[model samples]
Target chain A: MATDAPRRGAAIGWYVLLSALSLIVLFPVWMTIARALSDGSATLFARTPSVLPYSPIQWDAFSRAFTEGGLGRPLLVSGLVTLIIVAAQTATAVGAAYAFAFLEFPFKRIVMVLCAATLLLPIEVTLIANIQTLQEVGLVSPSQGFGEAIGALTLPFLAQAFGIFLIRQGFLGIPKDLRDAAQLDGYSDLGFLRRVAVPVTRPVIGSFVLIAFLSAYNQYVWPRFSVKTNRWDTVQLALRRFGLDNPDQLNLGFAAAIIAALPVLVLLLVFQKQLIRGLTAGAVK
Target chain B: MGKRRNVRQWALAYALLLPSLVVFAVFAYLPLYRLVHFSLYQQSSRLGGGERYVGFGAVWDVLSGERFLQGTWITIKFLIFTVPAGIALGVLLAMAAHRRLKGIKIFQTIFSSTVASSVAVSSVVFLTLVNEQIGLLRNVSWLSLKSPNSALFAAALSSVWQNLGLTFVIVLAALQTVPEELLEAAHLDGYGAVRRFFRVVVPLISPALFFLAIVLVVYGFQAYAQIELITGGGPLRSTETLLYRITKLQKNTDLQVGASMSLGLFGLTFLVALVQFRLLERRVTYGN
Candidate 1:
């Protein structure tokens, strides 16, 4: 709305400021990728090249990290774990949210309060007893076994209160008349859940899936508690191994770092809306 | 027939709740019940061998001891370093990108890019820069890893950056929800852009800011991966917050100690959450 001179100057100023801030935010990531692609180890003094990757980029870093640093194995484990968790949690949310939304059960109100209470009990607080239970049940091995590692990782997160709470919000929005109408059509409880209810809550289920997947994939602390070495490392745990390794593999660790972060970056870009929706669900009210 | 059907419906509902009930029972209630239960009993072995009943003494020791207080002070320092900056930057980013300037979507994506990176990914990225021997950013005041103070600062830097995306997205969404006409009205009333943002926009977005505070506080105390990755609780255990201390205790030494410390952390988190709910949550202004 203004004349050309000040407006153009203001726009240029904004661009400068925004780009500088963006560069600051993106700098670490950029540096990691830059390191991953370079020819040599970047010592603090003078060996470090200009900010971008050096010429003749080291593509072997990615492949080496994939094979040597054992990045591929953890990636597979993380994927499988994320898949199992997302499916299991979503199904559990459907059942629990269904009961809370529609069906009558004993101590329903008390159960609802307890479900809310679960939000307060973070995984860190419950680490000791949970690990004990896992050990006693032989789900985790002190010597580093996948049986225990997988069990310990997947079980604690099988049902999240946030997932149940989110689905219940969706279910509450379903009209009573719709359920009644389904009943008139001889839709049994399970039938309505399978058909109408599930379809109607697609957005909620989608958000739950993304959230659960991220939660399972991004686990760092639990993996340490579950497995001693890199044998059962999730990508997050594996990243630590790569971060601290000897000189040659150190470069691959940088590559592996980007590799570990790629899927999440893709997820954030693809499901930005759902991710935001899931994140802000608590914030809104 | 109706009575029989009602009973069947109740049975069906109960059956439906079984998986969630079992999961919650095993994961939530059992751990919760056992956190206190085990804290009361002293385990002789790291893997829970001998049991000596210690009652509330462990919890008391954990709360009143120097280690726990040291961790508490570090946790508070982390909060001070991260949360206000987190909220303020969130608001700033939202303000900058909330405007419909040229190519704003690109800037928006750039502003929110950190959301994609998790604690591990971000820590790895930060560690590459802050390593004492080889760090690109080692010379900086806070990112240096040799000293405990700067090492903890390095960990805090990662946490703050990692949280930026979530905070920015939440505040941006809150900004977008603020009606445009309100800002235009303020503009007509002679309020400058900065004044309008602080006076008009902030009150409306206080709910989002309040929510960010709660999440950041939770994130502050519960942060583990960054500390573990960046400094490994470092030079003098300076970077060790409560969660790091508890996990280290569990992994390295006795189960009872970790359990007791976990209980202390739980209590603190609850007290802080309750205080925030009581103190700051009321000032949050909801919209029409």
Candidate 2:
């Protein structure tokens, strides 16, 4: 039992070390929460940084963040834009992946190269010209309304090369016999795609969906320029403006930041498996 | 009949692929073409109000300019500061949590909790955390809020923290794939934990490390929200990355200059990707 005792002690040591590391990693988030819960008088004029919320915790920062900080509209707009982009990306990715996996066409090699090339040209590289293009098309102008700006925000992201590649890998995993049996049962190509391929590959699609939602929801650069006015700002943009505009009531800004991050944290909790799968898909063999 | 069926199948396939092809054409390919076209012209106003052909002059000017050089150098410095530190921390965290100890899953979750924070949220959190008046780290001498020189480091700190969750999750996944027998074999051979980690565990997980390195480099180049919210490329443009410079030029309606910088950034990224593959891929062991 001497060896057992040493092993158990080693494990306890590991626990202590890991717990300390986790606290350091999580300190910034904790500080934000504590500051958000404290009143302005408590946080602003304090000489020492408090690790926890001060007495008489104020809950009005969140309400003020939503109402006065103007995060409510942006939150709704971000949600709507995220939903549209997610749905469009899924549809486009599925169709393209299905074609690449199961069908043949002229210029197939060339088209595949074209699709892969887009992976190298990220949105940052094309931001300048895209803004001009969108402006010319009336999709991103001060004169345009919210609908056109939404088009601009969601258009460039309607399809993604990574999503296509990922879903194609999923489709390729379906056995040949499954495809032949579906055909023999008088299922058309589209019918097989809908009834068999999609159901079988739901896990991959789910992962892609979650990843796509996270990316779309957290987009900062595109929305920063595309949306012309505060009327159509996304949540990220609103948080920045609010934080910069309200230095005195920084607690409200912290609360808005928390509110902004709430959805993705909940998604992380619920879809932890899919997120890990999607994130590490291409990283490993 | 066979040829006709083939033609019909090909038509169906193309039909299915049309939406994606069209979107790519409009957004990706066309924008690249226009960026080149716009860069070659001199414009009198923001959106091409009055234009004159200026064959590569603006591009040459941007390439030779001090702003572009400084921005590129700062971006490279930012990459240097963040990438290795991020990978090292990720490896350390993964190693700590990769064991089969009881309740280890909770520790793993906490290690990756930062993944939920968006760049804006993380930047603001760090902003307040480092505020001079009331920040948690305000009194920390090295990261002093009074100095403008610490601006880039401050932004890099946030990026590293924000990326820790993703890096930890990916590395942990890689660590899990290390065969238990291999490590046990190494242990039985009288190798200490440190030696085994560097010799056995690292080589086995080198592919993931390499992948993480490339991704972090790309992320370093693409980082903007952190800089924008934290420093506003601030104090004296010390934190202005190439992408941030291009954004500033765009705001000033200098489309030609912005386009030139964008293409420059693209070429830089391409070169970096090539260099990384050349330097790092040789050591990556693919299979057991």
The best candidate in terms of TM-score: 2
Q: For each model in turn, which proportion of the native inter-chain contacts is also found? A: 0.69, 0.71
Taking all chains together, each candidate's TM-score versus the true structure is 0.95, 0.97
Q: After superposition, how far is residue B167 of candidate 1 from its true place, in Å?
A: 0.8
Each model's iRMS: 1.7, 1.2
**Model 1 clashing residue pairs (backbone):** A139-A148, A140-A148
Q: Residue B150: error of model 2 in Å?
A: 1.4
For model 2, residues A27-137, the per-residue Cα lDDT tens digits are: 898888888888766776777777888656877989988777878899999999999999999999999999999998889989988998898899988988888888878
Which residue runs does candidate 2 get wrong by more than 4 Å?
A: A54-56, A244-248, B46-49, B251-253
Cand. 1 TM to true fold: 0.95
Candidate 1: residue B28 lDDT (0-100): 81
